[model samples]
Target chain A: SQKIEQNSEALNIQEGKTATLTCNYTNYSPAYLQWYRQDPGRGPVFLLLIRENEKEKRKERLKVTFDTTLKQSLFHITASQPADSATYLCAAMNNAGNMLTFGGGTRLMVKP
Target chain B: NAGVTQTPKFRILKIGQSMTLQCAQDMNHNYMYWYRQDPGMGLKLIYYSVGAGITDKGEVPNGYNVSRSTTEDFPLRLELAAPSQTSVYFCASSYSTGAKTQYFGPGTRLLVL
Candidate 1:
């Protein structure tokens, strides 16, 4: 079975700094990888998505890099703020797109 | 748009009891999915429907059932609930385009004893 791993340890950074989260998968060559933001007591909200063919994608202050070579992806939030604190999840979808398998997720905390 | 909406935000059920978690979306999307999230674990897809009558099982569909009778509604049913069924459930919908983004509901919290 395919396995996805994200840093289980929370990432803590000072406000206005860049916060980076890592997602690595094993034995899975996904068609597309996506990132989501989740808060306590709520479902995840889609943030950004990058295909295996694409190297990187950015939206506003958020950026995502897909390095299929290493089976890893990096999610970066620039100028992070307290409000940006949340759990970040990475999901990998295969060619059939039947379902998205999600990683455990990394919690990001921006301190002021 | 109302995005996705799930009813009965919280519920408590006894062993062998059954209940349905209602999910609806006003986006007229063609793809709907049900997922469960347990502590320390990310979301796990339970079931998904491509359209109104086409349903498929996901990784954790063993204890759950789903029906998509309309484009806007996808409900998840739990028959004879068990302790392992206790988890937060979310319903999401997306456009027909493969790999399109999904809109998710607030999720329903279930507790079984």
Candidate 2:
């Protein structure tokens, strides 16, 4: 079975600082990895995605790095704000394009 | 685009009862999926459909059933609901592209006693 693990249960950071979340997977090599932001009582919204061949992808203040060899993906948010406080999820799809498997997710709390 | 929509934002059911969670999308996507998220746990895939009339079981599909009769609607049915079945259910859909970025509904919270 495939297993995905996030760095921690929660991370607290001050405003204007950088927040980094880790995702590690085992048992499979995924073609693409994605990140999502989820707030309370709402569905997750897509954030950034990085392919296996791509080293890094950036979107505004959000960035994602994929290391296929290490089976790890790092999600970073620069100049974090209180509004960025939400649960961050990591997901991956295999080469066969099968169902996407999700990690437990790391809750990010940005302090003002 | 209305994106994805789910019916009955919250529901409470007794043991042995049955109900259907309705899900629809106006995006006319080809891929639809059903997932359940328990507290402090990741979302577990229940069922998925590639297109109309093509469905497959996912990681957790023991007590759930789904049908994709149209490109816009995918309904998940729960039979003989149990305490273990109580969780927040989410429906998502995506286009047939390589990215496969799924759009999720607000979600339907189910409680079984």
Candidate 3:
């Protein structure tokens, strides 16, 4: 069966630190991978997307790396702040890149 | 643009009852999708439409129905709501390209008793 996994445990870090999250998948070769940020009691918002041919993508202080050979992706938030605290989700295309399958998400808390 | 919007932010339904969860988007996107999220689980696709009048079943489509009559409106119908149907429902829209980013609505919290 196909599976996607994110860090199950919550991550805590002080402000101005770098926070890293991981996503791993099996049995699916996606054309692209996406990251999303979701706050409590709210819907997810798109963050970044990395294509299979791209090794890294960055926007401001956020960065994402996709390693197709290892079936893994890493999300990073540099100089994190309290406002950046939220659950981050990783999603990948399935069924030939038409549908999306998401991981459970990793909760991140940045303390002031 | 309001992006994607879903009506009835919350609903409580009795088992066997039927109701429709409404979703609309103003982005003029050609692709729309419906998903359900259970506690501590990832979002599960219920159904999706590439364009008006064209729909397809997704990973978990049982007990739910959806119709896309217009480009801006896609409503999910729950026939005989079951306890298993209790979950947070989200509506999303994206461009015609399958790899494009999706924008999601706030979602509807449904409780079946």
lDDT of 1 by residue, B1-107 (tens): 78999999999999999999999999989999999999978988899999999999998899888888899999999999999999999999889886767789999
Give the per-residue Cα lDDT of candidate 1 at B50: 93
Number of the predicted model whose DockQ against the real structure is largest: 2
Candidate 2 docking band: high
Residues A1-112 of candidate 1: C-alpha lDDT, one tens digit per residue = 8888999999999999999999999886988889999999998999999988999999999999999899999999999999999999998875577778889999999999
lDDT of 3 at A98: 64
TM-scores for all predictions:
0.96, 0.98, 0.97
Cα deviation of A87 in candidate 2 (Å)? 0.2
Better of 1 and 3 by TM-score: 3
- Deviating ranges (above 4 Å) for candidate 3: none
TM-score of 1: 0.96
Query: Which window of ten consecutive residues has the lowest lDDT sum in model 1 chain A?
Result: A92-101
User: Highest TM-score among the candidates is held by which one?
Assistant: 2
lDDT of 3 by residue, B1-113 (tens): 88999989999999999999999999999999999988777788999999999999999999999999999999999999999999999999999884768899999999999
Can you tell me the CAPRI class of model 1? high
